[model samples]
Target: MMDPQIERKLIEIMRVIHESDKPIGARAIADELNNRGYDIGERAVRYHLRILDERGFTSKHGYAGRTLTELGEREMNEALIADRFGFVISRIEEMAFRTSYNPETNEGVVPVNISYFDKDDLETVIEIVSYTAHEGYMISPRVRIIEEDEELFSLPPGKIGIATVCSVAFDGLLLKAGIPVEPAYGGILQIENRKPARFSDLISYSGTSIDPIQIFMSRRTTSVLDVLEKGEGKILANIRQINLSAYERAREIMEKVEKVGLAGYFPPGEVGETLLGAPIETGKFGIAIVGGINGICALEETGIKIKTNPVSTVMEYKTMTEI
Candidate 1:
C-alpha cells in the first residue's frame, strides 16, 4: 500500500496532468507545483511520475513528458471527492470573475461547457443542438464545433467536441458591470404551457461535488425536447441571487448580451418575491436561466451518448458562431 503522504502527492500530480491540454514534462509539472506552494523539484516529480506510470494512471511520451491516462482521471475524480465539495460554486465564481466578454464590442472571453461524442454522430449532434437553440431553450444560440485538428484539449479517439456558452456567462457580464451575483442552486425547472413554473428538484451549489446539470443528465431527469414540442416539461436551469440595487443594471447588461446573440430568456423576480416557486431572500431577487446543456439533454433523451465537461473552459466570444 502507498503511504498516505505519497498518495496525496500522487493525487496532486495527477490533478496537474489532468488539467493540461498536452503532455506535461516533469520540469513543467514541478514548476506548477511550486507555484501552487509545494516544495517539490523536477527530480522528485520525475520519481513520483514513475510510480504513476507503473500504476497505469499515466503514460509517458518520449521527450514530451506524460499524459494522464483514463485511470488517472477516474482516480483523481474519485480519490478526494470530499475535497471537491462546493467546487462547482467556486468554479462559477472564478469563471465569472475571469469573464471579460464585452457585448458592445463582441470581444473578450465567456465561460463555456464542452461535450464530446462519437465522430459519426456529429451531424445528429448538430441537428439536436440547432433545434434546441432555435426553440429558445438554450442559454445561448452561440456554439463552437471543434474538429479533431482544432481541438483545444485531448479528446478520446473518434470523438468530436462542441462548446456551448454556459449560463454563468450572464453572471460574468453582471460582475463585469459591477453587479455582484450569488449562485444559489442548480435545479430542474418545470415548465408549464411554455413558461417556467417551478423547480421540481434542486441541488445547492455549495454542497455538491459534481455539477448538478451533469447529475440530472446522468439520471435522465430532463424532458427538454418535450418542452420544445409540447411546451411543458422539466429542463435544466439554475438560480442566482442578485441584490435589488443592481437589478436594473443587470437587466441592461442582459439586454446588451442578448442583442449580441446569447439568449437569456428569464428575468429577475422582485425582491423578496418567489421566482419559479423558489422564494427570494430580503433585498435580493432570483434569476433562473436555462442550462447551456439543455440542447445536449435533448440529445441524451434520445439515447445518444455524450461526455460533457460542464463549465469546462472559457473561450473568446468572437470565436464562437451562432447555431
Candidate 2:
C-alpha cells in the first residue's frame, strides 16, 4: 500500500494538473502549492511527478511540462466522490441534530415515518403522484395499496378520492397517447380588464402586439410588448427554431440577477417551448409571452390561465430589464 502522506501529495498534484489550462512545469506546480499554504519545494514536486509518471498517472513532455493521464483523472474523480460522500454525511448529521427529539421530555418530536418500495413500483407510484400534484392540489406522502380482495377505489360522496382509478387511468391514457403532460408558462397579453383606463394608457399601451420569439432571440426587450408584430405561424415556427445558445445566455443573465439578491425566486433555469397542455404560443400574433410565474402573471393579469407545477414557484420570468 502507498504511504498515506505520499498518496495525499500525489492526489493534490493530480488535482493541480487537472485544473491547469495547459501542461505545467514542476516549478509552477510547487509555486501554486506554496500559494495554497503547502510547504513543498520544486525538487520535491519533481520527485513526486517522477513517481506519478512511473505509475502511469502523469505524462512528462520534455519542454512543455507534465499533464495528468487517464489513470490520474480517475484518481481525482475518486477523491471527489469521497469528498462528496463526506459532505452528504455531514449534512445528514446536521439535519439529525436539528430534528432530534428529546424522548424524556417529549420535545422536538415531529412524528415521521419511512416507507420502502421495490424500485419499479416506486417509480410508477412517483409518476402517478407527481401528475396529480402538478394539477395544484395537496397530496399525502404516505401511499397505501389495497389488496385485490379488499380493493376500494371509490370513496363516499363527500370524501374525494385523491388518486382514484379513474384519475390514474386518465394519466395513463395521456401518457400512451404521447400527449405532453408538463406545465408551461406564457399567455396572451391584455391591458384593460383589470382597471379603468387612465391618461397614461395612451403612452404605455401601444395597440401593436409584440412577438415573444423575437424578444427571446434578441434577449434585450424587457416586456413582451416590444417585438415587431408577426403572424402566428411565423411566431410558432420561430419559437420551434429558437437558438438554444441564446437560451443559455439568458439563463446566465438571470443567474447574475439572483446572485445580486434582487430576484425573489431563483430557479435552476431550464428553457423550453411547452408546459403540460399549455403551449408557449398565445393566440394573438406578437402578444405571446413565455417564462415562469412572473411571465405567467403578466399574461394572467389579462385573465388567461397558465398551467404550472408545484415547483413553478421557484421560477421567475427572465425578461425583466430591471430587478
Top-TM-score structure, candidate number? 1
lDDT by residue (tens digit), candidate 2, 172-249: 122233322221222222223221111111101111122222233233222222111111111111111123434444
> Model 1: residues >4 Å from true position, as ranges?
1-48, 51-79
Clash count per candidate:
0, 6
lDDT of 1 at 26: 91
RMSD of every prediction: 4.5, 24.1
Which residue pairs clash in candidate 2?
182-275, 182-276, 183-275, 183-276, 184-275, 210-286
Q: What TM-score does structure 2 among the candidates reach?
A: 0.28
State the displacement of the C-alpha of residue 152, model 2, in Å, after optimal TM-score superposition: 74
- Writing each residue's lDDT as its tens digit, candidate 1 over 185-264 gives 88899999988889999987878987787798788999998998899999999899999898888888888777777885
lDDT of 1 at 198: 92
Task: State every prediction's TM-score relative to the real structure.
Answer: 0.83, 0.28
